[model samples]
Target: MRPVRLSVVTAAAAVTALAAVTGCAEKGDAKGGHGAIAVTAKDDSCEVSAEEFPAGHVQLDIENKGSKVTEVYILFPDDRIVTERENIGPGTRASLTAEVKAGDYAIVCKPGMTGDGIRRQVKATGGTVAKRSPEMDEAVAEYRTYVQQQADETLPKVKVFTDAVRAGDIEAAKKAYADSRIGWERTEPVAESFGDIDPKVDLREDGVADLEPGQEWSGWHRLEKALWQDGKLGPEATAFADTLDKDLADWVKRVGTAEITPTSMANGAKELLDEVATGKVTGEEERYSHTDLVDFKANVEGAQKSYELLKPVAVKNDAALVAELDKQFAALNALLDKYRADKSTYVFTSYDKVAEPQRKELSDGVNALAEPLSKLAATVVK
Candidate 1:
């Protein structure tokens, strides 16, 4: 999970900026080809073209005019992510199409891809979004079922891992760790959409900088450090295990109500690849255990599952893109298989054991897949 840093923009400053932006804003439409919200992301500012738009399938045409790589998001008032497009390199242009319900939302651009991001308040006016075919509706239902199933499957495994940590069985916890994470990894974007859950369950030490004051750090990586880095399952580690269990249980119970859409499914699939690229490929996620490959495979599987579910509509929309996606998915999976210790198990060579050159190969594979995957949302929404 990417950390949420404190925004540099203070409340008074943000209010001033919003007032100035509101004066020049116009109402935009999503159906008449005027739904594109033009965003210019810079080092210190995020400028969006409009302050209001018709609800439905809205498109964000983003240009990173900044010195650093950036990310853009549409967030609810409470900061729940409606949809987001991340990892846009400097001087590049990217587009994101998202389904928005009529409500107040914020258009955000995170230059350097951190923090609460520079924010501009926007509203989605009451209107019908793009119509979906029956098949598309069915796909969303099936994907929802799949996400819930993953959560259901994950709880028992997490119990085993947390139980081991509580019992001070370091070896058993180490063995249970990777297996427990697979389900969560597979549906991470969905979990993250809830805004409150992922941080409690998956936040790493690097994310401590992003924590709000009075929010204590306790989760999987905290327990992971006790097992591998500190070489003991102390009292704090046991407490962290309990905290992780409680947070994840909340996630499993709440996941079914998460909003799932065809565009979201497509966008989420791309986000999974981003997770692999940023965390798994860099060997930063499972730093102590070096079981990054297990998470890597699960992320890929999740992306592929989303693509497969949307393939019918996507293929009907853009056959060439579908063909390319299929090819890249197969190729990347084949490459990952080379590192597998056994076909029957999720085990693979420890990430620390992976040479730099092999890591680059994996990174390249991710980028290759990511480029096309980025277009999936627009494809399915079309």
Candidate 2:
């Protein structure tokens, strides 16, 4: 869907005002001999002057003064401290405090809102802030082993569900399908750490129109609709369900055989994210349509599966790491909620009516989470 041009213009004006207020940084002989840094969001960019500061207790006066919501993050080499102010409205400001030590740091802002939104290579000459410790390599390895085991155990049930459908056993097929779905959902917390990997394409919505012609059905809901007419299937419905069952089984087998690993997850996620971004920016036809939202949800479920497989490993080695994983998972769920809500607004509506700024905001929100999600996949093991 494309956003209207007027929204973009409004967003640009908001960004400009934000930048004007945040572009100042002054070096004064304060208590700690440190300087005050100002950050502004403007013209769809974040501008920071003298981003680098000496190692000492520093105060960041972040002014949103923009039309949209914003967040500011201070990234250390190994750890990060973030402050978010939601819906800052217009002509508003927020503040953040940090005692950062001497090292490389990055200041980043929300997506599509202005400036590079990132200030890098800030040096700290004095400060007693704590340094971040490196994650243990062994912990990562242990997590990978667990993920493989979970995949082995759960992927096969998808086949069982499909097989039941092919055998014309509607009751069994439903039970099996539900069980498999539960397994996938249970695994989603960890699977999300891996990135975008769809377990199987569900052809539930397309019904049995092309079944006799050997064309593929596209969603699981289609099959369900065929089977349940006024809550019960007749004799003719049996054959239709059987055909769907066979197709599902075939999809399960194919997905099971496909290779799934951290590297593949990273690459696939990057590719999908790029596609989503391009689709949003250029208003081009998307590779995946709204009908594919269920499939995307399933892919996220797969990530949860990976998470289930790895949580034990994380807990055994580092409690803090597990906590961080949980935080990432929560953030991911929040992102999905926002996506669904925005997507619902666009459903059954013409693209031209939707505001461009809204589209950009949605795209930016997804991208904001994607980097961290991809990184989590690389870091997670088992």
Candidate 3:
């Protein structure tokens, strides 16, 4: 919807939105693949050796034969990228796991890492995944379904919020803002699945680069300033609202097709906490309206949900890790919960209101949770 605007003022936990949106995959190729599928990236094209693959893990051994830097994506149904690696300098060979399922999918390569790349459909034979255990397969499937549900929940409500803003009914927009955010916050990682949409929709001011003479920032925060700081919604505000509406509606529809693996989920959780440490803990997120607490709470809730859904699998892999995460999550949540202003909001006048001692406690707890959570991806592979 929109953010509350009582007076001239302003607000990752929201970076959970940023990090989730901007994060991509690359490590050692241990994430997926039963055998390497040779890929070649050239100045004009990306060529994968195989047109069809058995459902399961497959290595994409890519050589950037092209003159320009290139990146590769394993696109699932609806063009959702399951995994990608960027900046493959010419003549460099890179590898990543394509943890795929039985479905129709595509491989896309961006020669200069901009715009939609050339696409080629590849069929994935169903019924078996040689590189994935049955349990791991099910876990990924279940997480994908969960992300889809959150997207479904987001679509219609966000429409209402945007409508309120377009109508210039500021009070109505304010009322609808928080609820509209919940679905998005819950599926921040899923939002990241869309290649170009996230940064455009939820970009915070901190991400703004030194604009030359022409660049302009836009997104929810831009609109937040209009309503909260500027204290009025000008005619252009309607256009900003329109963009947010269109992007959120469009992305939610495609999100279900995204591949969500345990490795990604594990990495996503750690990244969310990192956002908390770097942005939320420091009060860098909510610059105008002071709603950083709102995003902070959402990030924790989203992280907790990720941990919960994967708890059984995690416990199976390492009970000790799961136990430690449980304790750390509880500690952090307990600290944050005390700041709850009311049943619905948090009390911090600003993030700076938090004493250094308390801030350190929060930071320490997030750090504690992150260590165990970061290990989750490899734990799943083992």
Candidate 4:
């Protein structure tokens, strides 16, 4: 998801934070056990405890002493994210974990949640860490397969949507819209990992300010505004739809090569919850279509899928956390079920139809799940 630009959350009862990528390390005892690194985030500086560590399953224990909510990233020398933890509020502390091979890397902290951020040089200085347990490797393999499957399924649905838009069939296009987004929403972190794809296909108009010059806002939301808000489907909209199809096709082809790790999967699950809380719950995501619940359900499903894949290792590390996660997922799912028009279909009541009190319940459900979910990466890596 894009960095939040709107002040809409102040009016809604939900978590006020930007959606971000993966996280690392154990709590306390930050003297570098279990591949731990400590970081202090301030308004003007990002201070990392050490620049070197062994390869594999690294954890970052982060403390934000800054006034603004911050974001932290462990990046490849090329600036691709190895893992990240975002929306760490003032005075809060968070732990993020990731696996890495021997290489030079950077730890970046973005205070106020904007710009390229302050950078600190770091390195993983040894050969590949010992192989994890067979089950852990299997979990990563299974998640990679799941992510690829979602990407593969998305291209065909997106084509149907694009074709409908081109035909100027308003009802058909509207019907296909939510279906097209489900697969993308389910595995958004994977798409986002590609760096350029999400901004092209998922960036909303409000996020335009975050883009560099010459980068135009295109893809689903642009077409969404045309079909719902503008109520017009001209050649321009059709052309953009075709472009969206190509961008998504690119995502489908590239997702298989995306980095997948046990910690990344665990952190990705938390990212989905953040997606729901920041976008879906506030109804900012599907502003024109009012289909936020469709995306909401898909986000929850994606989070649950990641959790389930990692539950075996996580349960071994912390049985209580697994139980809380299971409970929270079920609770959230049940709440979403209330709006389902039918159990067999993806159909749901439009988000605009939801009342304020109901929205609060949804927000509370998301926050409840998000807290425990944030610990998943560290738990699994432990």
Q: What lDDT does each candidate get?
A: 0.80, 0.41, 0.64, 0.80
lDDT of 4 by residue, 1-382 (tens): 6552211111221111111235432245434445568888999999888888776656677888899999887655544455567778887777765666776777889898876688898877665655678888999899889998988888889888999999998889999999999989999877776566777889887877776667678899999999999998999998999899999988889888777777777778888888898889899999999999999999888888989998999999999999999999999999999999687789999999999999999999999998888888768867
Candidate 3 residue lDDT tens string, 184-221: 76667567665455666666765555222253566677
Clashes per model (N, Cα, C within 3 A): 1, 48, 15, 7
Q: What is the lDDT of residue 316 in candidate 1?
A: 94
lDDT of 4 at 115: 66
Residue-level error in angstroms, candidate 1, position 170? 0.7
Candidate whose TM-score is highest: 1
lDDT of 3: 0.64
Candidate 2 vs 3: which has more lDDT: 3
For all predictions, the C-alpha RMSD in Å is 5.9, 16.0, 9.4, 6.7
**Model 3 reaches what TM-score against the true structure?**
0.65
lDDT for each residue of candidate 2 in 1-382, tens digit (9 for 90 to 100): 1110001001111100000011112333222223567667543666765655666446566666456655555543332222222223345565444444455555666533222244444555554633322333333354445445554565567667556655667677655544444333323323322111221133223223313244444333434444333334455545555554454444334333332333333323333343344443333422222222333344444554445454554465456655765675566556555545464431222234446785566466555544444443323332
CA deviation > 4 Å runs, candidate 2: 1-177, 183-201, 204-219, 227-230, 248-256, 267-301, 304-325, 331-371, 376-382
Candidate 1: global Cα-lDDT?
Answer: 0.80
Deviation in Å, model 1, residue 71 alpha carbon: 1.7
